[model samples]
Target: MYISGIGIVFTRGRGIDSFEKALKEGWREPSRTGLIPAYRVGPETLTDASLSKKIRRADRFSRMAVLSAVDAYGNSGITVNEREKLGIILATAFGPHTTTFSFLDDILDYGDANVSPTKFSNSVHNAAASYVSAILESRGPTVTLTQFKLAFQNALILAGSWIAEGRCDHVLCGCADELGMVMECACKMKLNIAKDGKINPFAFSDSPVSVPGEGSVFVMLSKEKGSNNYGKVGEISFSQNITRKPDLFVIDTDGMSAYETGYKDIINYDTVIAGYSPVFGSMLTGSAFNFAAAALMLKNQIAYKCIFQDNPFGAKLCVETSAKNLNEIYCIKICRPEIKTIVRLQK
Candidate 1:
């Protein structure tokens, strides 16, 4: 399937303009949590009273998911009629944590009988996808999935199958995560963060980088290529074997030491390696943002620099060298303990 359009909202900013700008500039400014460097898509970014009049009462997760999907749909230039034929696949690791906890608080404070009904309704994992469907008025299949770190990858696999079976003309697929105080506290307790508030992906550190980030990314994909198509997504596999070397390599090195080892062992010495976690911070659903970055790089013919790390011995870092003849790109997503999913994209 071909990616017709992409929408991203992250700690850097919103839209393609902000995404590209952040890549070019690198990470000079990032929010700090205690000593850890954190990335966040400001709640104010989606809280415009005039723009979000309809979803003003919706929780942050619903607002973020709806806005990201709407942005992708608008960028795809897919009309309302066309959108009716578009299916939605939303993958999330931590869905509506803020609202979920709020409901829990209500239940504890007022008991089940007096708990807030609105919070209770929005606490489910599928609420974001439901809100997206309602806001978009999409009649096609809308599915929400959650599988820890591999949520987005699993969603992509399902979406590709749906398109192959002629289930829908197009599919809006992506992953989203919202930052919550409870999650951050858990990360701080379980993981280690850099003292300088910066993440170094290349170097080996004794302490793992525990910075938590949150955002949403949506891509409009179809079986046929369009005038605005960024690139073609072909053959998403959970199996780890690869026969051909890609022109560019995008690795999900999110400053977590555990996920970095397997990628380091697999990547070729001469292949060009690109990393973007410094700009977006580390999150379970970060691969969704990484996939968006790969599409942008293929479309623009310019590879953004890998911040905080030098180029490998035989490989060229995107910042110093140009990716001029990029035709195929490989994106590796490592979903903790043993799961590794590889996605192949071509121009």
Candidate 2:
């Protein structure tokens, strides 16, 4: 399947308008906070008429997914037919973060017997996917994936395979993550924070910790391409037994090794959109952030720079370039200590 269109709802740093403005301004002070970036969307972004009221009723992660899906579908300009074969593959590293914590609190305060059904229902990993299906009035297949940092990549792979298999005409694939007190506490315990409580991934300073942030991104995938806004979905690959240290993997390698092993042998692409930074923050749903960012770059015809840091295992590398040719292909490389993989998306 090909990636037809993409939509992103990130922390308030840069939307299409702000991104253009920053481009003209030379990207001097780009937003770097890992928190959920701000985004722009229409009032009709959500299909649920009660979404506005439900905003307070739902978890933050669910809200992000709902808002992002609306923006994505709007940008695609493809209306969903209830009877058409459609599917959804949603992913998240931390599912129902706020609700998870709230549920914990409830269990702590009132014990398991008094936990609210509302919270329990909303806390499921697939809640956001269910909401999206309901809002779109889609009765097609819906699946949720959770693979720690590989959640988004896994979802994309599934969506692509489903389309390739003729199981669905369209697949709405997305990844969403949110911050919560539990995450903050974990960061404090795990990372070596600076005086200001910021952790720079590039900096090997005493703090090897990454900052925390969250957002939701969506893409529409289809097998046949027409006059719609579309981006080429080149290829996806995965490798097990990476034989690389996790920290060194991100900083030392330009991600070239994974590309060479997985995608380079099959196809050659000109540009690569890196989704490393956003994923770097939590290392949980980092792939989602990178995938979404890369998709946006392909959709907007923009080049991007991917920065990696140095580690004891290897030398760090950052890639900075743009699409050089119209047929310029883009590849996404994902790796764990045990597995290394690559996915290719064409222009």
Candidate 3:
């Protein structure tokens, strides 16, 4: 599948321009105003006057997904005469947990029968996908997937299959997750929280430090190449054997896993490596964010400097933002040294 456009909602800002600016600005501290240091998407960033009245009752998770998907469609600039040919696939690790908590609070504070119906409706895992499809008016197949790991990658694999099966011509493939009091409490009790407000991607430690984050990223994908292309996503594999070499490698090592030392095994001495968790914060579905950065480099023909470059392993990192010839780029997500997932992007 080829990338026609990209839309993103992150802590730094909204839309592709905001994402690129964050890349150029390099490392910035996470918000300490929350229970923990997190790259939480602000309420102001999700406000869209045009969409406010339409999605007035939608939750934050659905709002992020709707905005990102809408932006992707707008950025593609491809006039779709047939909305039925457009598909949507939304992947999330934890879908709207805060909404569920709110519904539970209503039941406890009031009564089970007296709880708000809107809160219950928005708490489901597929609510984001429903909002995306309803707002986009896409009649094609809409799927919502939830997995702790490889959620985005799995969604990509399925999207390619959907096109291959003649189910849809274009797919709005992306991911959305939100950080709230529930997620914060879970992260504190389960993972190692970074107190210093900086994620050392080079740490590569067994007990990796995590600064929890939440956002949404969507890409317009099609079987055929379009006028504007980020690159082509093909040869997606779950096996460890990687044959093709790329201009550079974007590794997703944001300290979401228990053992992140496996990431170092894939590093070659010649190829430069980059990890962008510091810019976007830590999430299980961070592969989507990393892919966004790689797509920008290929589409714009400029490599952004890597942020938070603390070279513990002495790995050759992309620390400079300059114009260069980038024919190919690979966005890799490694669950373990033995089990690896790769998405090869060709110019």
Lowest summed lDDT across 10 adjacent residues in model 2 is found at: 247-256
lDDT of 2 by residue, 6-123 (tens): 6555544313343333322332212324332212222233335556764556667787787666566666667667434778888887788779779889999999899999898899
RMSD, every candidate, angstroms: 2.2, 6.8, 1.1
Every candidate's lDDT: 0.78, 0.55, 0.88
Residue 234 error for model 3, in Å?
A: 1.4
Q: How many backbone clashes does candidate 2 have?
A: 20
Candidate 2 has a TM-score of 0.73
Model 3 ranges off by over 4 Å: none
2 or 3, which is superior by lDDT? Answer: 3
- Number of the top candidate by lDDT? 3
Candidate that beats the other on lDDT, 1 or 2, i.e. the better one = 1
Ranked candidates (lDDT, high to low): 3, 1, 2
Arrange candidates by TM-score, descending: 3, 1, 2
lDDT of 1 by residue, 15-113 (tens): 877888888888766686433457877766776554477686688788778878888887888664765567999999889989989998988898889
* Cα distance off (Å), candidate 3, residue 127: 1.3
Tens digits of per-residue lDDT for model 3 on 1-347?
89998999989878999999998889888999878999999999899999988789899999999999999988888766688999999999999999999999999999978999999999998988898898888999999999988999999999999999988899999999999897898888888899997887877789888898999999999878888788988678886576766788888888888768877765653677877888899998888999999999999988887787887887778889999799888888878666688888878
